[model samples]
Target: MTATIHRLGRDQAPSLEPMMALVAEDMNSVNAVILDRMQSRIPLIPELAGHLIAGGGKRMRPMLTLASARLLDYSGTRHHKLSAAVEFIHTATLLHDDVVDGSGLRRGRKTANIIWGNSASVLVGDFLFSRSFELMVEDGSLKVLKILSNASAVIAEGEVNQLTAQRRIDTDEEQYLEIIGAKTAALFAAACRIAAVVAERDEKQEQALDAYGRNLGIAFQLVDDALDYESDGATMGKDAGDDFRDGKVTLPVILAYARGSADDRAFWKAAISGHRISDEDLTHATGLLRSTGAIADTLARARHYGQRAIDALGMFGNGKAKAALIEAVEFAIARAY
Candidate 1:
């Protein structure tokens, strides 16, 4: 088993540089497709979409598609356009999510919804969704289309699920996992699964890639959840207590609530019920999270999933692509550190 790499030493910190180098050429092609496809007669379509699209995201989903192809030793360029399509799907979700969450910042910058208003952001997101379908149709693979389209639907369902659970202090760990699996991990799985389809690989190989992506996605989300409470805004790329202020019952909060004292539980109920959103309350919440070991254990859960993601690649032969993907999992966990 490939052990989970810790980020205790900054000098040896895991980074995305390896994956970026591995996918540089193919990612360039995907970027060209993205730039060309984002153009439109209506100025706002491209402008608003570009604002978030060009935002400093790692483009992790599309990169997964490209890397998965390389892992299978695929030489064809079919995954390029599909990779752009995967990115478009991801960008569309981000735009809609910012609007729904009423988020003001992303990547340490103003969210599209904040700059263009909610309606514009949502409309532009719909435009991007249409663009993604066009790209998928151009790829002309029914399997790819089914995988991505189903992921899209599942993502929306997950968003809705989270919305319903929002501000409700009663949400549990199981429900939280289901929501993240749908909203975040669904596309990650689809991105890698479609690569196997385009590569003409066997079903077993496809399933392996899907599991790899899914577990990695879950680990990534878990880390982000921990960071929400453990990191500063500069490190988190957004507000530090955004999840807490918004009453999101992520795993850290779930664990803390379950293990909290009577007084602590009452505090959580009040904080999550939207009554304690001040800086002092957030400080208290953070102190509680630390005292109960919620944040550390949340990261432990992330390591568990990260290990699963690394192990999923066991059947693949050792090479640059496989090593990069493994490091990618390490980087995901290291983000919290």
Candidate 2:
């Protein structure tokens, strides 16, 4: 998002130049295909969809789909369909997420739920989800359909589980992993696996892509969790304390709660579990997180997953595409800082 962390000004940050070039080389073309698919005979649907699509998502899911396909030298056009399908699924999830989280902002702008009414946002989200299925059907790939459908189901289940798990100070690392894997990594895994389906690649290659996506997605979400504890609106593109305020369970707070002293844990129980948090309560919670080194520790775990994602690419042959995959891994972790 923000030039992959550097000492110089954002304008002079080194990572964006190469990252942009690689993205253009690998993703820009497919992005156009994605745009084309979003068009419908009904003009308003397309227009509303366009507004969200052009909003500030990094489009990493679609990029992964396209790049994974390219890595296997997929020469077929169906990858475009699959890529667009992945983007549609992702956009649909974001729309649903805004409603579920009751979020007012994303990427420093009002969320779809805030701009359009929640009803319009929900319907538009459903439309995008249906469009994704349509694209998959047109591609005539049953495997792709199964993969994405399963991911969608898992995402929904994960959201429900996470909602129940929220503010429960006793939630463990295993539960945290399960929640993130279900809600975030499921789609990432599907995105990469569908590319293998399009390429008709070998089983081992497909597994590698799955592993890459799973680990990368885990890393990405972990960084996001850390950002809620460590970042401001300027860097994070959303209000700080939104996660805790929404009663969402995330890694840093989970870690802090686990390792905190008796008084600190009691404080969390009052503020988080008892739903007693105020502005002052948020500052106190952040202080507890800082004292426990929870944010730093969570970031270390995210970096480990990011490294695993890069290593998972070893099964693939050497190429610019492979390099791009590696860069993607680094980019996922870099966003934490």
TM-score of 1: 0.97
TM-score of 2: 0.91
lDDT of 1: 0.92
TM-score of each: 0.97, 0.91
- What lDDT would each prediction earn against the true structure? 0.92, 0.81
* Model 2 per-residue lDDT tens digits across residues 31-106: 7866887787877667767778888877888878877887888877787777788889889888888898889888
Runs of candidate 1 with Cα error greater than 4 angstroms are 1-11
Alpha carbon deviation, residue 132, candidate 2 (Å): 0.1
For model 1, state the Cα shift of residue 134 in Å: 0.7
For TM-score, the strongest prediction is 1
